[model samples]
Target: MGDHDINEDHAQASDAPPRAGDGPRTAQAKGAVSRWTRRVHKIYIICFHRGFAAFLVLPLVLALVFVAQKNHFGADQCKARESGCGFVGNEDAYGLGIRLGVYLQWLSVFLVVYLLPSEERSLMTSLITFSSALMMAILVLTFGGTCTYTVEIIVLLWTAFMTQALASITHTAQEIDDAGIREVPVISGLKRATTFQLNLDSPQGMHGFQSGSTLVEMCILGYAAWFWVCLLRGAEMVFAATPCGTSLFFFARIQDRKGIVVISALMTAVSLATLLFRLAAWIFRTSVKRWFSKRTYDMLGAVLVSIVYLPITLIAGITYLVPDTWMLKMFPGSGGREQLMVFLCAFVAFIVSVAGIELLLVWNGISDVYGVGSTGQLIPLTMGLVSLMPILWKLLRRYMAGEPLVPEPASNGSGLLIRGTALPHQGSPVEMAARQSDREALQLP
Candidate 1:
């Protein structure tokens, strides 16, 4: 009977389910495996994204360096009064190598753009690539070694500015899409205010240049106009100060004190004006929320911004009309004192502009209209760091800390957890109860 009972007990024990401890052990193993898997996945994603970005940017850098070197040599030749010193003047092996490199780099840009994933390749990216390639071709064919260093620098700066501005606009548009606020009434009104259409079928339209336009197109036109004016004015100032015999190699020697003054003053004025406009809009929006619709307030805000910005533009234009000497006289200083003043003005201007733009985007319902949060902060931060090192560094830090690259979806009070599963208690309830009893007993008198 004892032998039979022992056999039955053994069978029952063998057939029974796993111990309670085994479940936790299995879960721990799973958690560890998942953690490692996530780390590997993160590393792969970082490598992929950054590698692609670097590939896209490399051609532009190489092209700029090669073209600038070639142009510098050509400019040097021209300055020496050498015969046949023009864009096509250089046929030496070195010159040919530079030209070949430039051509290859330009081609590489197109190739890289083509290789981008379809989802990543947008109209703006195409346009930027095309424009950059066209500009490079023009510079190579027309200017060659004959172009002044100042002219070369200006062209490069203009290209970079245009690229950055278009990128910003594209990013903003994407944010708007992601926020799902494209159909917002205030946004629609703003779009309408900025956009214009011309009817070619109408008799009056035949005489006038008319076509459909978008907010992006309008912003482009405005940027182009502003940049051209600033470039021309700044160029005039630089040329006037720079001597004819100034070496092309020492391009920085070109006195741009006047240019600095004008830019600093203009930036300061515009930044202050933007801040004031933001404040006024906020006050108006708050005060009239009960009296007027949001769309109306937004439209009024747009009008107010335009009114404020227009005067600043006009004033800048009028200043450009005045002589540089006259402008300089307005800010009285000489030597180091003048330089210090210029530095202060520029510093102040930059600080104020950053602050103003940040407030305008965050507080003025701009981000709300676009359906973004603190991500909008990236617009200002990343715009200034075109090299993208900071962004990459941020990603690396986040990954190392085991934090997510993208922000978690904000809680909407739905009480539905999106991230981790519920974890079991570290100690069993019975063990906890025993510990509590011990502490209670120890405290008893």
Candidate 2:
């Protein structure tokens, strides 16, 4: 009888079905949620691996190779495969030298920005960083060579300014005349588009960014380059005036007074020409003029370009003739020269910094402005200050509600159950009661 009872109990336990309160629906819901989540995750992974490569990665690699070539020579020589010498060293390497100079100045700017980490950088920022690095690497190649300190300074500042300008344009512009809107050039096409994807007739057509911002970025870059050239000329002139003892041998051996005078004259003419060119460009949107006139605008831009060329031509001319007095005349005076120079440099730096800051602000406001706009420096500073308001409000609300400064999960045992459904405890109530009774009986014995 005892064996039969035990057999009957085992059979009953085996035949019994699960209770309806086991939260089977909740389990099924969780399974559905998990499946969707996995699908989304897989899509993201595929996009990252394939799309990033097809659109962004391959172009970057090509740009890097070009950068490597420029490090050895300049941008000009990178494409010159015919120059008998396969690479090591070549003649009149100064043009490449100037390119190297631009790279270093930008490096300092990059370092300063990192001091305050902003939110995550976007594709535009990454491309700018890459381009800047490449430019800097090229500059380093010319570190101890024949390029003068003045030339290096000018190049560095100009290069950095250019990189920043390009970044702003690439991020904001909807399309270039060539590149389709969908696949824009992130950095290389600052002034104009150079990427393969910039086809004009694609479905993602270009709508063009704000003309104002583009003009500003271009102007800033132009001015930065001009400033470097001026500083270089002025510094060179000053050094010429105070030749050290070591310069005596070379000074005496070479004396071409007429050549120096002619060179100086040519440089002056060029400076005037560049100034004219700048004026014309500012007035007339076109790169080429329809007609020539004696208008002051055309004259000014021509003068500035001419001026940029002047220092080189001027220095070359004076290498033999004018002597130290002429140089001193060209350099800015030395009455507290250190203080004056600092103030001037700072002023220019402030303007460039503002250019960068304004770009981000305007981009955020892009939707309303048709991806084209300019905000005052004051506006950016104000916006940056105002961004803090939301963060502060969140904090204040938390404090007022008497909510724990940090979140604390509920402490009730029953409340520990998840939100959607209730799950019953395992085992039948009758079985639990019988087990308790058996325990009581044992204690009594």
lDDT of 1 by residue, 1-445 (tens): 1234323422432323445767877765565444433333332222221222222333444453345334434334444532222122222211223222222332222222212111122433433443444344434533354433333333233333334333322222223221221112222223433542232233222111111112222222333333334344543321111123211211122224555545435544553343334334434533554687857854664466457656534443443454546545553221222223323443444344334323322221221222213343333223323323333454465456554433221111111111212222235575345323322221211
lDDT of 1 at 123: 32
| Residue ranges of candidate 1 with Cα displaced over 4 Å | 1-50, 56-130, 133-135, 138-143, 171-445
Estimate, for each residue in 106-209, the C-alpha lDDT of model 2 and write its tens digit.
Answer: 33233222111121123234334434543443345333232222222333343444555434322122122112212332222233332223222342233122
Each model's C-alpha lDDT?
Answer: 0.33, 0.31
- Highest lDDT model number: 1
In model 2, which regions exceed 4 Å deviation? 1-152, 161-174, 177-217, 220-278, 281-445
Q: Cα RMSD (Å) per model?
A: 30.5, 31.4
Per-candidate TM-scores read 0.22, 0.21
> Best candidate, TM-score-wise?
1
Candidate 1 is scored at a TM of 0.22
